[model samples]
Target: MVDERTRYFRRLRRLRNSARRWSVMGGGLAAAAAVLTPYAGIGLADAAWAAAAGASVALAGWRWRDHKALAALPAPPPPDPALAGQRLVAAVERFPAGRTVVHELRRQRTRYALRGSAVAQAWDRLDRAAGTLSALAGRLTGPGEAAVLEAAVAERWLRDLGQRVASVERAIPLSPVDQRPVLASSHDSLAGQFTEGVTAYERLVAAAAGYVAEDGQPVVDERHPTLTRLIEATDRMRGIAEGLSELRRHPAV
Candidate 1:
C-alpha cells in the first residue's frame, strides 16, 4: 500500500504540474483572443491588435517576474569541515579527569587495542557512523543530481545512526563513583550534555529528511529554520561526542 508520505509527495507534484499547465493555458488563450479580435471587424481590428499586444506584454511580464522570484531564492549552505571538526573536539572536552565514565572508557579502549573487545567495537562503530553523517552533511550544498542522491542517502543514514546512538546512550550506566557532591554534579552534567547532543543530532537528521523531501529547493516559507537548527545541533553533538571519545582514549588517573 502507498504510504502517507508517498501520497503527500505525489500531491505536491500534481499541484506543481497543474500550476504550470494552467499558466501555459492562460497565456495561450489570451494570445488566441487577441488573434480573434482582429478578425471580427476592420474598425475593431486596430483595437484587437492593441489588445493582443497588451496581452503578450502582460504574459511576458508575468513569466519574467516568476523567473526572477525563483532566481532570488537562496540555496542551502554547504557543509563545513572545520565546524564539524570543532564540534568533535568540543564533545571530547566534556569528559573531565578522574570520572568513572572516563576510566571505564579508557579500560575499554585498552581492551580493544589488546583483544578487540565488543565495547571497543561499539565505540568504533559509533565513530564511523558519525563520520558518515559528517561526510553526507558536507555534500548538501549543490542542486545537482549528485546532491539530491547524497541528501536522500544521508537522510536514511541519519535516521539509522540516530537510533543507534539513542540505543547506546540508553545502555550507558551512570557513573558509580559519584560519592562526592562534586563528582555527582559532574556526572549529572555529563549525562545531560550527552542527552542534549543526541537530541540535537536527531533534529539535524530530521531536518535533512525534510530537505530531501522538498527536492533540495530552499523554500521561502520557514526559510529553512530546521536547517539553521541542524547546523547548531551538529556542532553541539560533535563537541559532546568528541569529548567523550577523548576521555576513552586518555582517562585521568
Candidate 2:
C-alpha cells in the first residue's frame, strides 16, 4: 500500500496530468468553434462565447510553450575525458581561490557561509562538475553501470561537502582575519569530503573505461591521457590542502 504522503503526491500528479489534457482539449475546442462560427453565422452572444473560448485557447498555448521551453533546457554533459579534465582544472582553481577569498573575508569581520557570495561561485562550479557526471549516467552503455552508481555517490558527497564548508564559515566568529582553530578543522573536513568524491569518480571513470560492449569493445580509449590528467588534477587539489594545512601549522617567516 502507498504511504499517505506518497498517495497525496500520486493524486497531485494525476490532477496535473488531467489539467494538462483539459488545457489542450479546451484550446482545440475553442479554435474549432472560432473557425466554424462564421459558416454557422451564429448570433452575437454565441459569437462572444466563441471569441472567449479562442482567447482561452491562446492562453493555454502560451502556457504550453513556456513549459516546453523550461523542459528543453539541456541536462548536464556526459563524463567525457575532456569534460573531466575541464572540471578537474576548474575544481582545483576554485579550491585555492575559495580559501583565499574566505580567508580575506574573515579578515574583514564578515560572516562567510556556503551561501556567501564569495564561495558561492566556487560551489557553483563544483556543482556543475557533479551535474556533468549525473548527466553522463544516463548516456552510459552496458558494463559501465558502475559509473551511474558512482555519480549518485558523488552527488551525495558534494552535498556533504557543501555542508562542511558552510559549517567552517559558521564555526568562526566574525573577525578581521580567520585565525580560528575551527576554520582549519572545517577546511580539513571539506577537503576530505572533496577527496572522497574525487576518488569515487576515479573508480567510476576506470570502470567506464574498462566496460566492454556486447561485441567485446572497450567503451573508453586507454590511450587518451586526458582522463588520467583529470584524476591527477583532483589529486593535486588534495595535495594543496595538505600543503595548506602544513603551512598553517608551521608558519614560514
Candidate 3:
C-alpha cells in the first residue's frame, strides 16, 4: 500500500498539474480574445473573454478546495517496525513457551512485512495472535496464572488492533469528494490511537521483561505498573476500532 507521505505528494503533484493546465488554457483563451478584438467583431471577442474568465474562476475554486482537503489530512507516522517488533516480543515473552511463540510470531510478522503493505502486516499480526491463542488453549486450562492471563489479554488486543486496521483500510479507499473532511478526521484519529497503543504496549513489554516469577507464577511489581497501561491502551484501541466500524457502516457518499 502507498504510504501517506507518498499519497500526499502524489495528490499534490496532480493538483499542480491541473492548475498548470487551467492556467495555460485560460491565458491562451484570453490572448486569443485580445488578438481577435482588432480583426473579429467586438461581440465575439467579448464572448471569448467571458469564457476565459469563467475558466480562471473554476481553476481558483478547485485550488481552494484541494488545498483545504490536503490540509485536513493527517501526517503519517514515521516507520518504527523495530520498536513495534520489540513490543510484540516482550508481550509474547510473558508466556511459558516464549521462545517458540515469539519465533513463530516474528516469522509471520516478517513474512507479511515483506509483502509491502501496512494493512497486510496488521492482518498478519492478528493471524499470529489467533494461532497462538489456539495453541495455548489446552495449556491455559490447566492453570489460572498471571502469565496466562497476560497472554490472553495481549492476544485479544492484537486481534482487536488488526480488526481496526482492516476497517480503516477499507474506509480509506471509499472516501468520496464530499466526505474528504470526515475521511481525513477518521484517518487522523486512527493514527493517533494506533501510536498511543504501540507506546503503551512498549511500556508493558518493558515492564514484563523485568517481571519476576515465584513458584512458576508471575509476580506483580508495584514500581513497573504494566497492567494499568495495558488496560488503558486496550480500551483506547477498542474505542477507536468502534469508531472505525461506524465509519465503515456509513461510508462517505
Candidate 4:
C-alpha cells in the first residue's frame, strides 16, 4: 500500500501545483485586462477593469487559501526512513494493520527485547486478525443480514482485539528446547482464543441473517439477542487480553 502519509503528501503537492497554476492564470488575466482597458471606449474600459478585478480576486483568493492549508498540516516527516533501528521501523511498516499496533508493541517490549522471530510471529497473528475482522465486518453488513453493525461498536472491538494481540505477541519470548512446549501451548491458546472470537462473530452474523430471512428485520440495540452475543464474544476476547497482560507481567523464569 502507498500508505496514508505518502498519499497525504501527494495530495498536498497536487493542490500546490493547482494553486500555482491558478495564481499564474489570474495574474495574466488581470494584466491583460488592465492593458486592454486603456485602449477601449468608456463603457468597454469599465467592463475590462471589472473583469480584471474579478480575475485578480478569484485567483488571489484561491492561492491564499492554498498557502494557508499547506501551512496548516504538520511538516512532512523526515524524508524516507530514519537511521535509528531503521530495519525494525521498516518491518513495522510492513504490518497489515499498520504502524500503530507494532509501534505500541515495541514500546511495551522493555523486558523481552525479542526481535526477528518476534516480529515474524506478531506480524502473522496480526495479519490474520485483520483479515478475519474484514471478513467479519463484511458478514455483519452483508445484504441478507438483519441489521447493520454500528461502526463505533465495531471500532471498539477492533481496537481492543488489536491491542491485545500486539501485547500478547510482545510478551511471548524465545525459549530453549525444554521451554518449546510451553511456548507452543501459549501460541496454541492465543491462536485458539482468536479463532474462538472470530467464530463467535460468524455465528452471530449467520443467526441474524437466518432470522431476518424468515421474520424480517427487527429493532436492534444493545439489548438485542444477536447484538448482545457479539458484545459477550468481544468481552471474552477482552478478558483474554487482560489475562495475557497479566502473564506478560509475571512471565515464568
Local distance difference test, per candidate?
Answer: 0.54, 0.61, 0.63, 0.59
Q: Tell me the tens digit of each residue's lDDT in model 3 across 1-253.
A: 3456767777877876777777677767767777766643578657868687677858856875786687677867765778667777777788879977777766667455435334454455445444544454444433434655765686567546645655665566688878867876775676556545554544544344334223235355543457668988999999999999999999999
- Please report the TM-score between candidate 4 and the true structure: 0.29
Count of backbone collisions within predicted model 1: 10
State TM-scores per candidate.
Answer: 0.23, 0.31, 0.30, 0.29
Writing each residue's lDDT as its tens digit, candidate 4 over 1-253 gives: 3545676778777777777777777777767666666553647666766676677668767766976787698865643554535666677788777587875575456224434432334434444444444455444544533344443354346445545554665455555668767766775675565555555555555655564454545555426678779999999999999999999999988
Off by over 4 Å in 1: 1-132, 142-179, 216-253
Off by over 4 Å in 2: 1-113, 116-122, 174-179, 195-253
Q: What overall lDDT, based on C-alpha atoms, would model 1 receive against the true structure?
A: 0.54
Show pairs that collide, candidate 2.
107-176, 107-177
> Model 3: runs farther than 4 Å from truth?
1-144, 213-253
* Rank ordering of all candidates by TM-score, starting from the highest: 2, 3, 4, 1
Ranking of all predicted structures according to lDDT, beginning with the best and ending with the worst: 3, 2, 4, 1
Candidate maximizing lDDT = 3
Give the number of the best model, judged by TM-score.
Answer: 2
- Over 89-167, each residue of candidate 1 has an lDDT whose tens digit, in order, gives 5566577643446545654564445243223343344444444555556545554345446545654554444444444
| Candidate with the larger lDDT of 2 and 4 | 2
